[model samples]
Structures are given as C-alpha cells and as structure tokens.
Target chain A: MFLNMKTAVAAIALSAMAGSAFARDLVINFDDLNPGPKKGFDDAVALFQKENPDINVIVNINDREAHKTAIRNFLTAEAPDVTSWYPGNRMAPFVDAGLFQPVDDVWEENGFNDDLAAIKPTMSRDGKIWGVPYSYYQWGIYYRKDIFDLLELEEPQTWDELLAACGKMKENGVTPFTIGTKFLWTAAGVFDYLNLRTNGYDVHNALTAGEIKYTDPRIRATFSNWETLINECGFVDNHASMSWQDAIAPFANGDAAMYVMGNFSVDGYKNAGLTEEQIDFMPFPTIDASIPGAEEAPADAFFIPTNAKNVEDAKKFLAFVARPDVQTQWNKTIGQLPINSKADISDDKFIQEGFALLNGASGLAQFFDRDAPAEMAKAGMEGFQEFMLDPSKVDAILERLDTVQAEVYK
Target chain B: MTHAAVPDTTASARPSWVKRNKLAIAPWIFLIPALIFFAIYVVIPIFQSLWLSLYEWNGLYSADGESTATWVGFQNYAKLWDDPNFWTSLRNNLAWLILFMLAVPLGLFIALFLNQTVPGMRFYKSMFFFPFVISQVVVGLIFGWFYNPDFGVVGTLWKAVFCEETTNILGNVTFTCSRPAPDILSSPEWATYGIIAAGLWPQIAYCMILYLTGLNNVAADQIEAARLDGAKGWKMLWYVVVPQLKPATFIAIVVTVIGALRSFDMIAIMTQGGPFGSTNVLSHYMYEVAISEYGERYGYGSSVATVLFGIMLIFISYFLWQMYQDEKGGR
Candidate 1:
C-alpha cells in the first residue's frame, strides 16, 4: 500500500510539473516599499496579470536603498525576469557586463523611440537601450513664496537678479539657500545646476565623461559663480550635519528662502507643514545667456536580466508598462513625470510646472551623481560640499576632484 | 575466517579496540558540526577575500559571464599606497585602537564602584548597562541628535550661555553665538573623536559587565588578607584586586580591540566616514570602495580587507599564543 501511495504521489508531481511547464511565470523585482510607488507598481502588475491571464506574475518588492546592493547579487545568481533600476551611467556598469538584456526591440514595438526620446540617451549605452524609463522628475529651485512676498522680491530670472535677490534676503536676516549635504548628493544637485547654467549641458556631459579637466576654465567659471553665491547668499549654518529632510526644518520655519531640489521633495516640504501657496517652483536662474537652459531630470527604469527564465513574458510586461496610459497612471500615482511624452500628467501645480520646465529645456542632464561614474560622483559631491562650507577651499577641492576624475576615468 | 582459529584472543581485542579509541573519536564527533560551520563561514571567506584581492573585479559578471576578472597581482595594494583615503583610514583606525583601550579601565572602575552595596544599586547597575543593551546604531543616533548645533542639547546650552537673540536673513529668530558652536560631526578634525566617544559608551558598559562577573568571583579571604597587609584603596586595587581580575581584563582588552577594529556600525550611523571621509576606519573605507553607493572596486576593497585581516591576525595570533602558554603552564 505504501509503494502504491508513492507511485501515486510521483504521478501527481509529474502532472503538476507539466502544468507549470504549460504556464508562463514572470518574476519582477521592484524596488520601492513606499506606499505610492508600491501601489503604482502593484496596480500596474495587476493590470498586466488581468490582461494576460495565462501568465503567472510574481512580484517581489524591496526597500529602494537595499535593492541597490541586492541587485548585483540577484541579477546573477537568481535572476529576476524584470528588475527596477535607475537609467543613465548608473546602469552602464551592468550593461557593459552584459547582465542586462537590451530591449531595443520592445522600444521599437511600443514606439518608445518617439515617446521616450527625452530619456532615450540616458537609457541607452553602446547604441542599444538597456532599460525602459518609467518615470523622471525635474530638479530646480523650490523657494518660499511667503518669504519672497514678505521681502518684496521678484522671482530671480538672471544671475544678477538672483544675486540681487540674495542680497535682499541676506539684508533681511535670512540665509538665501538651505541644503543638507550630510548624505552628499544634495551638493551635487547644486553643482549640476551651476554647471548647466554656466557652461550649458554639453560641458556638463563632457566633464562628467572625463573629456574635460576639473580645472578647465569653464569649470572654474562654474566654481566662481558658486563662490559668489556662497558669499552673498549663504546656505543654512551647519548644513553638513543635516540630511535633506533635516534641512527642510529651516525652510519650513522660514529661516531659509530657497532650496535646489527635485520634485520628489515637495511632499517633504508639505509634510513639514508648508502649504501649496507658501512654496513655489522656479527654473534655475540663467548664468550665461549664450548657453540655453537645460534642466536636471534623473529617471528610474526597469530592465530584463539576461538570465531571465521567461524572456517573452518579461518583454510583454515591459511593453505593457511602456504604453502611454499605463505610464500616465503609474507616474500619476507616484507623482513623477512619465517618460512617454504622450502620457497624461497630473493637473497638480508642481507637476504642471515641472512638465513645462522639462519640456521647454534645450537638453536634460541627469543629475551629477547619476551622470558621472559612481566613484567620481562621490568625490565630486564631497568637493561640492567642502566648497559650500568653505569657499576658499574651491581650488583645493577642484584639484582633488581632478585627481579622482583622472583615477576613475583611467 | 583466519581469526576464527584465535577466536578468544580476537574477541578480547575487539572490546579493547573500542575501549582505546572511544575518547579520541568521541570528541571529534562532537566537534564536527561546529568545525563545519567555522570552515564555511570564517576560514573559507578569509582565503576567498585574499584571493579576490589579487584580481580586479566589478563583482557582477566575473562569476559566470564572458567578462571575467583580470588578474592584477599586487596592483591593488600598489594603488592603496597612493590612495590618501587609505592613509586617513589607517590613521583613524590607530586612533580608534588607542582611544578604545580606555574602556578597559573605565569599565573596571565602574565595576568596582558598583561592587559596593548601596541603595537601589542593582537598578543603578542596570541603568548603567542600558547603553550596551541598546544597539550601536541607536547610540550613534542619540549622540548625533545630542551634538546637533542648532536644536540639540549641546547647541541649546551653548546658545543659552554665550549667544544673543538675532534674526536670520529670512526674518526668523535664531541664536547667533559669539563664538560659533562647534558642529562636532561636521568638522573633520572632531568627527572621528565624536564617533569614538559614542562608541565608547556601550563598549565601556560591555567591559563593566565582564569585570562585574569577575568581581563577583573575587575571594573574600584575599581581600581581608590584603587589608590586613595594609593594602587599601589604590594599593589594594593595583596589587591585589587587579591581579585577581587578570583573566577578565585580558578578555575585556581582546574584545575591545576587536570592537574598535570592527568600528563600522557607529561610524556608518553617526558620520558615514564623512565631513570629508575623516571618520573612516579600514572596514568602513573597505565597504565604501567595495559596495557603498560610491562605487564597486572589489579588488581594491579586498586589498583593504586583506590588510585589515593581517592586522587582526597579529592580535589574534598573540592572543592564541598567550592562551597556549597559559595552558602549557597550567599543565
């Protein structure tokens, strides 16, 4: 009787194996445990599952920062069919190593070439697109509207105007800018905006790519402007001790007038008790008139791993997510701009302003950290922070950065 | 079949074989699981990290893909010589080692004070032990807030004592101290010291617990004898109490050294080796190079790990040798 039971169990297991073989399963590793992003991802996955009932979808979500370290291990050992990641030079290492599958065909099939054109260069490396950017957000000056009103200050449009506004703000006993550089990346945002404003997008790209030296005259010009800003319009005292969230306290308390930050930080400002009318967004003031304005917009993307067990299903999911409606809904829920131009954006004021700002830009440079190689980015941000803290250290900081740049590029 | 001719002799010898080998075999059988675990988790990884240090790898495709790690020999070590961060990390490590040694005496002092019977002494002991019970990350965070220059206790105290009320540029009231309050974590010169102070809180507690147990085992007769010999206070502690507490002191010193060397968590939580990477010890620096958001230079990180391992090996070897000598003396 026991031998008969064993044979029966084996038969049932064989049938189950056959049943699984007949069905296709796709594993997706998403990185965002926050309510909004998680809901958006889950809803998208549910939609995909409903549309394709035959396909079994397994969704694994993790904390964003944890995912950064976990991806390298998972992509090789237990490869997920699809994984979320950042676009730009961030994905370059994995792409160069051939760990990510090039999904140019999906882009072509979904007509993403036209839709995702703004972020195409970022998502592509070596002439093939490695991932699909689902959402991106513009970085610009987020300023206190009440402070500007109280000081009778017009929103600064030109460098001289900005300097004048900063002078007024300083005269009234306010620090012109508040930033937290403890984590280092906030400093990079300032540097990117300065470089983009001073020398424009091409120089910023060339500099990040190591085609130009840190001590180059153009780069020096950017640093010169930064020094002037630091002297005339000081950041909050003790910025190096604070994180980005911590910096918001002063901004909320009305001690600081402006912050150079991404759209994602708007929620933080609101949560810190600032109302919509109290805060307003502005394009980074122009430094050199000859250089057309280019804003910083870092994008998040998804890729199919090369070792994916179900490539077809992963591609289908990618294509589904790339659709304009899906992109619109997903981005709307996450409060980020969809890469697909046709994707309908939220009527939220900040979203509208970001859309206008990003759309009108001559070019988009991914923020400094995302643009440069990670090692160089780290050193560069540190230099930026040091320069902010002590302007006299500009030359030293730049020289040190040049050394790191040379080492990293080599 | 041949032994059947000498059946009585063979039967007697069979029981003798079991009797002779049982002690030898039994201990090894008991040790097998632990040995297997140690080999897998500890022994193997050390050699693997050493081997990896010889090759340049990004750690992604090197395992299975076409892009294999290139054998770079000792080039990673060569690069380390030129790397300023490495030197800074080494210096900071030395600082951690030297500063961390203070915990041993501090622990012993606290233990001695608590050894006396007093009102609610047990409660006081537990309260003193609180820092050690809490995780290092929490201690780092608590100290981080405590040291904040704006709203923290230190900042508030400084402002109250030394500053006048002034409005900032944005028309908000804030303190403008006559002498700017030191932002400890933000200053490269002070950041390491600040983190080390946070680390010492729990470490001192740990040492206190060790010494407390040792103090419980202290012989009453010996103390009386020392008192009869007119050895009291410092003299009693120096000649009698400390001598009896040698084992606890040794263990305390060994653990403190190891803790100092592995001082990554507090630094990671408190400063992240920042304000220009000033607080970095070798382990944190190794992590920054290998796997932090900065970049992955696995070969270089492995080289750093190898150097750290070498430093630790010296201490561990000395400790083992001392133990061996003590064992031999006991025999």
Candidate 2:
C-alpha cells in the first residue's frame, strides 16, 4: 500500500516539473524595495504582461538580501524564466559557471552603446555583456542645508572646505556625520568614496577586484583619511550599535549636521519630515590638491540569469524596462537618478543635482559589492568596520583580507 | 501426521494456542511507525550532509548559470585547519558554552526565592517566567537595542551612574570606577560575553521554570524529618531539597548546555561576527562560509558544519550512554 502511494506521489511531482519545464511562459523574478521600488517593477510587469498575454508571467518579489540567498535555491529548484541580479565581479563567478544569460545581443539590439555609456562597465563582465542595465544612481554626501547655513558653512567645494564644514558643525555641538557600521557595508560607502577621491576611479575598481592589495600604499592613504575623519572630526555617537535606519534617526533629528550617503537617501529624508529646503546634496569632495577624475559609485542594478527558460522574452522584458517611461517612473519612485539620459526627471532638486553629477562623471564604478566579488567584499567591508572601531588593528585586518583574497582568487 | 491430527480434541487445540505467543509480538507492531520516522528525518539527513561535505557546489549555482559540484575529497577539511575564522568561531562557541552555564545556578537561586508560599507568589513566578515565552528573534532585537551605546537604556544608565561614580549597596559613595563601562558589542574582549549574556536572559528563565516544577514534587515528609533532625539553613536545604531536585538539575544542565552551544540568532542579529569578527560562533561562521552574500565555498562551509556536528555528537553520545546506564540501573 505504501509503495503504491509513494509511486503515485512521485508521478504527480514529476508531472508538475514536466508541466513548467519547457513552457513558453516568461516569468520575471524581481527584487526591489517593497511598496516603493515595487511599483516600478509592477508597472514594468504589467506592460510585459499586456504585450505577451500567452506567456504566463510569474512575479516573485522578495526582501533584498533574502533574494541573494534565495537566488541559489531558485537556480536549482525552479529558476525563473528571467530574474534580476547585480553586475561586475559579483557576476564573474556566475558568468563563468554559466548561471547568467549573456545579454550582449540585447545591449547591441537596443542601441545601449549610443546612450548608456555611464552604466556599461557595470553590465559588462570580461568584455562581454552578461546582464541588462535596468537602473542605477550616483552616491554622495546628503547634509542639512539649514544647519550648514546656521554654522555659516557653504556647500563644500574641496577637501579643505568639507573639513571646515565638519569642524564648524562639530563646534556647534552637532555631530559632524552620522553613519551606522553595525552591518559593516555603510563603512564601504565611506571607503569607496574615499578611495575614488584619493586615487581616481580605475584604482578603486582595480583595488576592489583584488588586483591591488588592501595593504597597498594608495589603500593606506585612503585609510589615513578615513582615520582622520574619525579621530579629529568624529562620526555620529554610538554608531557601532545602530543599524542604517537607526542612524537615520540622528540625522532626522538634526542632532547630526551631515550624512555621507547615496542619492537614494533623499526619499528617507523626505519621509523623516525634513522640508526640501532643509536637505541638500554635494559631491564627495576631492581629497588631494589635484585629482585625476570624477568619483561616484553607481548603486543598484538588474541582470538576467543564464538558466532563464525564455531568453527571447527575458530580452524583451529587459529592453522594455530600459525604456524612458519605465526609467522615469522607476527612478522618481525610488528617489534615485535614472541611467537613461533621455528619461525626464521632475522638479525634485536633489535628484536634479544627482543627475547632473552623474552626467558629467568622468567614470562610473559599480558600488563596492558589485565591483568586488562577494567573498572579498565581505572581508573588505568587515576590515573597514574594524579599522573604524579601532585603527590600531589596521595591519592585522589588511593582512587577513589579503589572505582571504589569495584563497578566493583561484 | 495429518491423519493423526484429524482425531484432535481439546488437548491438541491447547498445544497449538501455546505456540502462537500473540502478547510477546504486540510491541513490535506498535514500534514500527516511530522507527520509520526516525529513519527518514534523522538517519538519512545526517548521512546526506556528511556525503555532501565531500564535494564543492554553490547551493544555487545551477540556477544562476553555474553547474553541479566537483568532488574534493578531504580538501575542504584541510582548508578549515588553516582558516583563522574557523578558529575564532570555535573559541567563541567554547566561550558561550562555559559562560552560559552560569544560568543554571542563577536560575536555581531565583527559583528558591520565589518558592515561598506567600502573596502573589504565582504572579512573581509568572513574571520571572516571561522571557522564555517570547521568540528568540524578539529577544535578539531587544538585546541589540539594549547594547546600543548611544541611546539604549543600558547605554544611558552606563553614562549616568557607571561612568565615573561608584556607589555602595546602600547608595553611598564608596569609591570611583576608573574605567568606562566597555562598549559590549564593539569591543573584541567583551563581544562574546555580551552575546552570552543576551542568551542567558531567556535561558535562565527556562531553567527557573523547570526547577519550579521540580520543587513542587519535593517531599514535605522528608523535609519535616530533616528539620526534626536539626538540619536547617544551608545544610538542611542542601541535603534535603537539593537531593530531591536531582532530576530537575540534570535536565536543566543538559538544556543549558545545548542552549549555549545553539546560540545563533542573537549573535547574527547583534553582530555579524564583527568588530574584527570577534563574536562568531560555529553556526554563524558556518552560514557565513556557505552563504555570505553569495559565498560559493559549499564544501568548505559543509566541513565547518560537519565539525560542529561532530563536536555536538561527542557530547550527545556521552549523554545517551549516561541515560542508557541509568535505565539499566533502574531496571
């Protein structure tokens, strides 16, 4: 009796697998912020659904990091026809393994070269396109304009001006900056920006990709500047225990005068009840007297997986998401700058500034995690956190990161 | 022989009935379902995990564009031998087990305090029992906030009184505390202790609840007899109550040991083995290697998990053997 039941169940399970394995259905599994970025994804899904009604579209939206863990499970169990992922060294291992569908054809077919130059390298792995560029934004300093005016600090134009602003903010009993290193990646924002400003964009990229060691002189210089900011200027109080959201509380209360953050932080500021006039944006100031290039890290992107059941439909979805209307609606909702140059932006001033800087950028480097492989990025970010908490352990931390890189590379 | 059997009477029927032995075979039928359950959930998975530890495959490589695994023999285990993160995790697990054992005695003391049959005793017992009722995630969140050095309640209290001033039990100034109250989560020296302390909050509650139930079963006749023999205070309770509470003490210690070793949620929530990865226990570190932001070192992670499983197995085997001996002695 048990054998009969087991056989019946096995047969049913097999039919379920066989039912969906080769269907023309195009399922796009999206990972974006719920209730906000989700709207953009839904809008795109609606368009694709309308365009191809015959194809069954499955939309699986998950919490951001949860998607990272789930991606592995999905690849084996029931991979979506199309899904989103990041680019850069983050894609290399997967690309090498053939997990992501190469979308060079999509790029060329859509005239991606003529316009989206700023976001090309992000989607490119080993001189070939492995994913489509959905959207990306520039990152920089978000500070309170009213507090800056109160302290008689103009928008910082250079390194000295920035430090002067920090000093003035500190003098008035306001914490100069607020950042939470509890999860360790916020430290990456500060580190990447500093590295980019110090040694230009290429060096930053090379360093993250493990071509340069953490103990390199240029890397040491970045740490020195990071150390100066912590030792003399001071960061927000009790940053080690706070999450990124918790850190926002101090900035929201105006207890802290400035926050070095991504352009995405604008929405958070608006939600925190700060008027538009109170919040303003600026480029991360150049640290050296003379620097080679513009410095900005691009945040958040999308890619199609290699195991996609319907490549043609996946390409169609990718191209559709790249359209101006989609980009405009998506960026506005997420409070980030659109990668598409033709996308119309609203009267939101911070978005305008972010757009301007991103337009004139000499180079666009993918954010630290995207630029570096996952293992290296993990160690690097942890090292940054440790250095911030205790600079004395810099040598040991760097050495450990170097050892991990050595093992992970081969 | 059949022809002879055709002449059967009551005596022949009685012989056939005697050989059947139905009562002796009944228990085997009853044991079959539980045996099958154990075979599937317990035995199969253990062997599978061990076999999987011999090969390298990202849990999701096939979906992402990667393929299946390559067998690496003992290479994964060899790599673990040289990995500093592995050593750090092992040290942290040991620290948790040692420090978290403090809960048993502490819980016993609290249980004794509330043992008095007075007004609102049940209320006090229930209040003391509250921490265990909440889930670990909530406990982790609450403790994470508590350890916040900026605006957390503990942080505020540390700043207000524990900063430089010292007070006696009666609140008189005795001397001054020289050093600052350490930043518990961030400091390498104290991060493990902080997590262990967080774990103890609920664990002590669990132990207290067990002991409370144990104390109810303590014999009043024996206590009165001991009292009549002039046994009182420390000696009386030690000899009488403690002897009666042996069963509870054994279970409490066993749970406390397991709870200490199994502390993963609080550490992950509070610190991701950070401030130089000082707070990593075996479980969190294993997860980190297996699936830390797409870390695809599957064989390596599994080996770490296997080591953790092995250690747990040693303790578990000893415990089972002890139970077996006790059962035999009881028989």
Q: How close is every model to the real structure, measured as TM-score?
A: 0.93, 0.89
Instruction: Give me the runs in candidate 2 sitting further than 4 Å from their true place.
Output: A1-24, A48-58, A299-302, B1-28, B63-67, B159-182, B292-294
Enumerate clash totals for all models, in the order shown. Answer: 6, 11
What would the per-residue lDDT of candidate 2 be over residues A1-87, giving only the tens digit for each residue? 353244335433543544534246566666765777877776666565555555556666777787877776775567777777777
Query: List-wise, what DockQ does each model earn?
Result: 0.49, 0.28
Q: lDDT by residue for model 2 over B100-161, one digit each (tens)?
A: 88999999989988899999889989999999999888888898778876657777777777
Here, model 2's chain A TM-score works out at: 0.89
lDDT of 2: 0.77
CA lDDT of each prediction against the hidden true structure: 0.89, 0.77
Candidate 2 residue-wise lDDT at A368: 78
Weakest 10 consecutive residues, lDDT, candidate 2 chain B? B168-177
